[model samples]
Target: MTMPQMPDSPGTARPFSAELWTAIDPVYAAILDHPFITGLVDGTLPHDAFRHFVVQDSHYLRDYARALAVCAARAPGEDDVRAFAGDAAGAIAAEQEMHAEFMDRLGGSAAQAAAQPVGPTTRAYTSYLLATVYGGSFLDGLAAVLPCYWIYARVGEALLAKSSPDPLYRRWIETYGDEAFQGVVRRVVALADRTGAAATPEQRAAAVEHFVTTSRYEWMFWDAAWRRETWPV
Candidate 1:
């Protein structure tokens, strides 16, 4: 797909994250169509499903931090390193704070949370990420994980615009849709765009594949949550 030129900055004539967003718009459209998101927006989603997602997400965030650390270490500049490391810490804090609140409201305990096994979809997603960061280029890893930040911000904004009446659903939407979170997303996007612009064609293709695969995983995550997925014993 040809990336459209975005509005230029004061003296710069380069495209930013907007072009990348256009490239992935098809996958993104499918994500919005997923029942898990629509259900949340309409408040017809089963409480059990959202509860499952919160638990799975809490576990997922722990490993996500480790992956972020790997990316931070591989970052080309100190600023990128710091940005990624700060994001890692933020993920851990959100996992602790927000999940704790959800658990209190959704009938779960720390003991149960600690003991819960990783669901298959969550395991696959995180494992894919960890492997990517371990074996791939720094740019590849960044693209791989970009969806976690970018997708959430976009979905949050969309759902928040809908303004669900269910408090539980609303909280999730508001959290992701917060302007602060979008700022973080934009920072990551800028970093990725810069990196992409400097990449070789082969390198860019590899990064695009990583991005596409992870984007599909994001879709599966919501679908898995809706289905209340579990590992086979």
Candidate 2:
């Protein structure tokens, strides 16, 4: 099924998701220009850097699945409950295969990747997400997790226009650039719009803050991989 687009207009009141996206447009623009992202486009990224991303991302997804399960439990309606719950499962089951595939191509096994320590940025980003989902309202959880879905879909689509010649890099791009993944993101975006529509002013404001913070984390996650972020102490 096709996901509906969120409406945004300067002259009219926009949906909460639209507002959130507008608030982070600058951040997203910067992300598009980031070296990490451009690396994927041109196949210039280092092998170890991409390996670092795959390892850290495997860890990130496990915790993100937990956060989504929290969202499912806190959701107001059965449809949303099912959506988040199913996505939580998909994160663990379906997406894990993709990660493992990349890990293998990068000369590592799932077991080896599992033994790798999570990068500092990965730890911080997942911690913030888990904290928001457990401590804040359902709307807040939705906002906190939105960028992972939305930003990847946007980045994937953008990179698809000039896909890397490297087969491994191209596969990574194709994973997120797939229409199925985009539809999943659109569903989450619609949920954010619906939930945001009913939120109090304070809640809406909180959602915006969470949205921007996580969007920034999205950038940091890629940058972390680019820099091969690690613990100093």
Report lDDT per candidate.
0.86, 0.89
Q: Which candidate number maximizes TM-score?
A: 2
Q: After superposition, how far is residue 19 of candidate 1 from its true place, in Å?
A: 5.3
- Give the Cα-based TM-score of candidate 2 against the true structure: 0.94
Distance from true location, Cα of 167 in model 1, Å:
0.6
- Note the residue pairs that clash in candidate 1: none
Candidate 1 lDDT (Cα, 0 to 1): 0.86
Q: Residue 193 error for model 2, in Å?
A: 0.8
TM-score of 1: 0.92
